[model samples]
Target chain A: MSSITSSKKHPLFWVLLLIITVVTLFPIYWISVTSLKSPVEVISSRPTMLPQAPTLENYVSVVKSGFFRNMFNSLLVAVSATLLSLTLSTLASYALVRHNFPYRGNSLFLVWVLVVKILPPVVLAIPLYSVFIKMGLLNSRLGLIFVYQVYTLPYCIWMIFGFLKALPETFEEAAMIDGAGRFYILTRIVLPLARTGIIATSIFSVIAAWDEFLFALLFIRTPSLQTLPLVIVNYIGEYETLWGELMGIGLLTTLPVLFFSSYVYKYYTQGFSVSLK
Target chain B: MTQNKYQKSCFFYLILLPAVLVMLWLTIYPVLNVFTLSFFKYNYLSDEKVFVGLGNYIKLLKENLFMEAFRNTLVFSVLATAGEVILGIALALLFYGHFRGKKSFMIIAIFPMMVSSMVICAVWKTLYHYDIGLINFLLRETGAQPVGWLIDQSKALFSVVIIDVWQWTPFAFIMMQAAMGSIPEEIFEAAQIDGASYMKTVFSITMPILSDQIMLLIMLRTIDTFKLFGKVYALTQGGPGNSTETLSYYIYREGFSYFNLGKASTASIFVLLVVAGISFIYIGKILKKD
Candidate 1:
C-alpha cells in the first residue's frame, strides 16, 4: 500500500478538488453561519453568504433552554452502552479467538454477531417497545441503554474480534505457560495491548448510541428523558421556523462526533479498513 | 495437559456465556416475538389481541400505502446506493494523484459523513425550502423558476435521496481510496511504460483491481440505504402525499403513531426478509473469498 505514490499533477485536479471540497463542506459552513445569524437574517429572502450581525443569541437560547440536560442524557446512555458493550464483547471475542465451542469454530460465532449487527433497527424496535412497556422500561434511560446493546454489541464484537485475530497469540501463550489464568492473561496481557482497538470500537459504539434517533424517538416520551437527537427533533417542532436556534442545536449535535472522529482519525480509518478485509 | 485443556475450555464457556446469552436474548427473543406477533391482530392502545393467521400480510399486500412505501424504499435504495458509489468512485479517481494539501482536502470532504443524518437533513431542509431557500434564491438569480424541492410529490423522494447521496457518498469514496492506495505504484508505472493512456489505466488496470472492494462497498451501501428513516423523519416526515414514505417510516408510524402492532410486525418481517437476503449474498461472497 505504501509503495504507491503518484506525483502526477494537473490544474484540472486542483480545480476539481476545490469544487468537490466546496460542495461537500458548504452545508456545514452554511449551518454555522445561520446559527450565528440574527433571526431577521435567518429568514431573509436573500441569503447572506456571511452572517451580518453575528450573535450568540441562538446558542444562548439553546443553553438557557436546558440543552445540557439532554446532552447529559445522551452522554449517559452512550457512555454506559460503550462501557458495557466493550467489556462484554472483549470477553466474547477473546473466547471466540482463543477457544472452541460445541460443534463449530469461531467463524460461525463471528458471523452470527455480524448478522446481529446488520439486522434492521426497525425490525427490533417494534418488538422491543412492546417488551419494554411490559417490563416498565418505557421512557427510562436504562431502557434505552439495554436496547442500544442491540446496536452497539454486535459491532463491538465484530471489530474487537478482528483486532484480537490479527494480534499474535504468543504473549498470551507465554503467560499461560507460566500458569496465568485465562482472566489474568486477558486483563494483564491482552487488554493493554488492545487499547487502541478498544478505543476505536468504543468510538463507534458511543456514536451509534448517541446519534440514534428511531429508538430514542419511539422509546422516550418525556422531554427531560430524551437524548440529543430527540431534543433536536423536539426543537424543530417547538421552534418552528426558528432556523437560527435550530441550527445552533444542530451544530451542537454534530460537533462532538466531528471532534471524536478527528481525534481518532488514524485508527478510525485503519479499523474500518481492517474490518473490511 | 488434558486436565488443563478441559479447565481452559470451561473458562472459555464461562467467559463467552454473558455476551452469548445477552445477544441471543436481545436478538433471538425479540425476533421470535416479532415473528409471532405478526400472526395476531394486536393493538397496543386498546389491549386487543386476536388470531389473524396471515390476515395482516394479506391486508398489507392489498394496502396501497404499504405498497407505496415498499416501492419508495426500493427506489430510494437503488438510486441512492448507485449514486453514492458512482460519485464516490469519481471523487476517488479525481483525487488519485498526489497533490499539495490532499490530506486536508480529504478531511474536509469526509466531514459530511461524520455529522448526524438528522442534522444533515435539517441543513438541507433549509436549503430546499420553497421560496427563501438558498437553492431557490440561486435559481431566481439565474432567472429560472424556483423548484419546490421537498414540497412537490414527484420531487420529495428524489430530494431525500439527494441528501442521502450527499451524506454517504464520502463513505464509498473513503473505502475506494484506501483500496486504490494499496495498489503498488509499479503496476501503474508498468502500464504507463507500455504506452497505455490514463483512461486506459483507469479502465483496464485500476477498475478491475478495485472491483472486489467496489462490490463490497455497494453491498454495504445497499443494506444501509434500505433502512431510510432519519432523513425522512427530520426532513419531510414522508409528506407531500406520501411520496417520500419509506418502509422504515411506514413501519414507525404504524407501530408507534397508531399502535397497530400486528400490521407493523408484518411489515417488519417483510423488511427483515429483504435485508437478510441482501446480507446473505454479501456474507456468502466474503466467506467464499476466504
Candidate 2:
C-alpha cells in the first residue's frame, strides 16, 4: 500500500523495472536475431546490433535436413502425454474432491503422489533404461509417451487437487439433485468450470515432454525417431560448431510453448514445479 | 441398488487401475530394480547378469568419481540454494512495496522461470564463453583479467550455480511475497510503534514469521539443484576433469555413456536415498501442518 503511495513520486522503480525487463528479454531477443543473421554477422566481434538483411538460411537448413520431423515427433509425444495425464488426473481429482468414501484419507495419498514427483528422475534412469531395452520399447513413440506421462501425471494430479480444493462441492451436489449421474455431472458441469485449470496443467505436461532432453537422448537411438532437443544437442557436432543453427532450432523448438504459455502463464496453475524447482 | 453401488465402486477402481499400475511399473518397479541391480555386477550389452551380492555397492563406496560427485553435489546444492533463497527474498522485498511498474516487473521476473532449461543453458553458455563472451568482455573493460568460467575445474560448479540463480530466483521471490502478504499490517505497525527500525521490524517481526516459508523454499531448491543435469550438460558436459560432475550427471554418464548398468543402478539408489530423506523432512512437515 505504501508502495502505491511512493511509486507516484519515485521513478526509480520504473527505471529498475525497465532495466530488468530489458535484461530478462535480451538473451531471447539476441537468440532470435542471431538465428536470422548470416554466419559472418553472427560471429563478428562487433555487435550485429540489427540484422542488415535478415535471412531464413538457418531456418531452411534446420528444416530441409529433416529437423522438423524430429520436432513433430516431440510434438506428438508431448501431446499424447499431456492428453493422457490430463484425463487420468481429472478423474482422480474429481473422485477425491467430490466423494468421501469410507476410506477417504486422500490427502495422505496425495502426498504420496507428491513424493513420487520429488523422487529424482536420475534414480529411475538406469533401471528404466534396462526395462525399456528388454521390452523392446526403446526408440518407440508409444513407449516415450508412457514414460513422459508417468513423469508428470503426479504433477497433473497435484495441480488438479489444488484447483479442486477451492471449488465448492455444492455445484456437483446441485447436478446430482437435478438427477444427473456422477460421471455425467463430472463431464458436463465440473470439468467445464475447471477448464482453465486443466489447460494450465496440460501446458505444463506438454512443455515437460517437449523440453525434456536426458530421457529423449538416452532412450532414442534411431536418427528417424530423435526429438528436437536431441537434434539441437547433436547438431553441435564433435568438431566445428554451428551456433547460428543451434539458436535457430532452439527458437523453433520452444516457440509453441512460448506462445502458449505467454497467453496462459498468468493462470493460477503454477504447481510443484515452480514450488519444487 | 446395493449391487449397483458395488458395481460403480468397482468401475471407479478400474478407471484408477491403469494409472496406478503404470505408476507402479514406471516408478515403483524401477526403484525396486535399482536396489536389485545394485547387488549384481551386470552389463547391458554382454548379456551376463551375475549376482555378486553387494559387490557393485562396495566398489562404488571406494570409487573416487562417486566420492567427488557426492561431495560436489552437497556443496553445489547448499551454496546455490542459500544464494537463490536470499537473493529471491531480496528481489521479493525490493518488489514487495509495489511501484508504478509492478505488473511489468512481475512478468519479467517470471519470464526466466518459465523458459526451458536447455534454452537458458544455451544462452548462458554463450555469455560464459571466455573468448568473445559478454561476461569476459565486461570484465576486460573494467581492467580485470578474463577468467575461464566453465573450463576452470575449481570454478565450473560455481559457474553453473550462477546460471541456476539467474533462472530460479524468481521462484523464491514469488513464494516469499505470498508469505509476506499474509502478515497483518497492524502487527508491523505495532512493532514500529515499539521503536523498531525498518531492519528491526523486518528481522524481528517479519522474518521470524517468514521462517517456515523460507524453509520450504530451501528444501525445494536444494532437491531441484541436486538433480542438475541440463546446466552441466550444456555448460561443461561434466568436463575439465569432472570438476562439475554431480551425482545426477554421474548417473547419466554411468548409465548412458558407459552403459555400466550395475554401477549406475548403485549410484541411483544413493540419489534415491538422499532425495527421499529431503522429501521426508519437508513433506512430512507440510503434511503434519495440515
Candidate 2's DockQ is 0.44
lDDT per residue as tens, model 2, A1-277: 2321133534665566677678768878767887888877766665455787899998898787898788889889999988988888888777676555455547756776777788768788877777888898988987888788557788888888777766777887787778787678778888888887787778777878887877887788888898887776675534124667777887887677667534443542233323432
DockQ each candidate and list the results.
Answer: 0.55, 0.44
Could you give the CAPRI-style class of model 2?
acceptable
lDDT of 2 by residue, B213-258 (tens): 8888998898788888877776788878989988989988887777
Per-chain TM-score (chain B), model 2: 0.95
**Poorest 10 consecutive residues by lDDT, candidate 1 chain A:** A268-277
lDDT of 1: 0.85
Task: Give per-residue CA lDDT, model 1, range B22-47, as digits (tens).
Answer: 88778888889999999999998998
lDDT of candidate 1 over A139-178, digit per residue (tens): 9999999888888888898788877877899998898789
Looking at model 2 chain A, which ten-residue stretch has the lowest summed lDDT? A268-277
Best DockQ among the predictions, by candidate number: 1
True contacts kept of 2: 0.39
